[model samples]
Target: MRKSRYIAKEVLSLFAILVIAPCFAAAQGSEQSDKEVKQMIQTQFERMYEKGIQNLSDRIVLTGGVKPFAVVSDTGDNVKAIRIRQAEEMPPEIALEVLRRSLIALVKKGKIGATAIFYTADNPNKKSNADKVLVVEMEHIFGPTLAQLVPFTIKNGKASYGEQVVVDMEKQIFNIKVDEESAE
Candidate 1:
C-alpha cells in the first residue's frame, strides 16, 4: 500500500510539472512579444508624425480662433493639424484642454478595449501564433481631474480617435465636423 501511495505521488508531481512548464514558457514568450509590439508602435508614431506635420503645414487653413486639435491614438501617436471649431468668445486653450481632457478621461475608464495578437511557438491546436489583447487603463491627473486612457487596438498598439470630435461650443449642441481628409 505504501509503495502504491508513493507511485501515485510521483505521478501527480510529474503531471503538475508538465502542465506548469508550458504555462511558464508561454508567459515569457508573451512578455517578449508585447515588448516587440510596443516598439513597432513607437516607430509607426514617429513616421506618422513626420508625415502629418508636413501635410498639415501644406494644406490646413486655421481660422483665426481655430486651434489645431492634437489627435492622439491609444498607441501614443499624435496626429496633428486637426482643426477644432471653437467659440470666438471662449479661450482657445480652454477649448483645447476640454477636448483633450475628455479623451484622456474616457481612455482611463476602459471605454476603449485594445488587443495584441502573437503566434504561439509550440501549439498546433492554437495555430502558429495567437493574439493577446491587453486592456490598459491609465490612472493619472492632468489638472483637476483623474484621467484614464486605453489603447484602441493591438495591431498597432494605438487607440482609435474616431468617436471624439471637436465641436462648436457656441452652438450648445455637440455638432462638429471631423477633418477626415487630413486625418489619414
Candidate 2:
C-alpha cells in the first residue's frame, strides 16, 4: 500500500472523536466531522471572545445573573444559540452540567461544532472586587479546550467588567494518533 497521508485537521478530529471526547466532553464540547465548522471555531474565537463575554456581562449585571447558555457554529457564518429547559431554582453548577452534557451529545452526533458555553458564577477563589462572574468555556475539535472568567461589579445600574482572567486548559481535544487508529 502507498504511504497514507492525513492532514493535521483530519487527524486531530479523529482523535478528538475517538479519545478526547469521552474524557473531556464533560468539560467542553467534542469533535465533529465538519471541517468548516471546526475551522470557523479555530479562527473566530477572538471575535467570539469579545462578543460573548460582553453580551453576558451586560445581561448579568441587569438580571443579577444569566442561565447556562451556548452558541454553536454550524459553518463559517451559520451560528445558533442553544436554549435549554433550565429550572429557575437549579443550582448554578447543576445547570451548567446539564448544558455541558447536552452539548456533548450534539457533538457526538456531529450536529454542530465549535461550541461556546457561558454561565454565571461566584468563585470564592478570586476576589476581584466582584462576587459574580461570567464563565465562558469554548471547545473546538481542531483546537484547544479554553475557558475565561470575566469578573465584574455592578453599581448604579452599570456593570464594570474587570480584566478577563484566563483559565489554564488542555488542548488534546484535537490530538490524533494515526498509527494507533490503524492498529485498532
Candidate 3:
C-alpha cells in the first residue's frame, strides 16, 4: 500500500511538470516579444523626430473653447493598431466647420466621432525595423471621413519622410501626395 502511494505521488509530480513547463516557456517567450515590440516603437518615434516630422513631437492644441474628447478604438489589433494621443469630439456641424477651415471639405451633416492626432507603427511582423514605416493617420470627418497617412521611414540610421498617403474610401483607392516641406 505505501509503495503504491509513493508511485502515485511521483506520477502526479511528473504530470504537473509536463503540463506547466510548456506554459511557462510560452509565457517567457511572449514577454520577450512584447519587449521587442515596444523597443521597435520607441526607435521608430525617434526616427520620425530626426526626419523633422514635427507633428510627431509637437503638442497640438485645438483652437476656440472646445474641450478634448476621450479616445476610442474601432477594432482590435488584427493588423496594426493606431494610437490616438489627443482627440476632440465635435458635433456634425462643428466638425464640418473645422474641416472646411482646414481645407478638407464642406458638408452639412454626419457625426464626427473625433478629431484625432493618431499614429500607427508599421507591421511588426517584418523581421527588421528597416522594413518598417510609421504613419500618422489623421482623420477629419465632415459628411464623410477624410483620412491622411503621413509615412516616415528610417534606414541605415538615416530618417526620412515618404509620400503622404490619402485613401478615398468611396472609391476604395489610395492617393499619394507630395509633402512640400519634406520634398524640399
Q: Which candidate leads the pack in TM-score? A: 2
lDDT of 1 by residue, 91-184 (tens): 6446545544444443445322111111111112233222221111111111111111111222243222212122112211011222222221
Pairs with steric clashes in candidate 3: none
Q: Per-residue lDDT of 77-111 in model 3, one digit per residue for the tens? A: 11122222232355533543343333221111211
lDDT of 2 by residue, 28-125 (tens): 55454344345545545544444455456567767877888777664333456676766446876787777766766665555555677777778555
Task: Give the TM-score (vs. native) of candidate 1.
Answer: 0.32
Alpha-carbon RMSD of each model: 23.7, 12.7, 23.3
- The C-alpha lDDT values of all candidates are 0.29, 0.59, 0.31
Between prediction 1 and prediction 3, the one with superior lDDT is 3
Count of backbone clashes for each model? 16, 0, 0
| Residue 38 shift from truth in candidate 1, angstroms | 2.8
Order candidates by lDDT, high to low: 2, 3, 1
Question: What would the TM-scores of all predictions be?
Answer: 0.32, 0.63, 0.27
The best candidate in terms of lDDT: 2
Q: How far is candidate 3 from the true structure (C-alpha RMSD, Å)?
A: 23.3
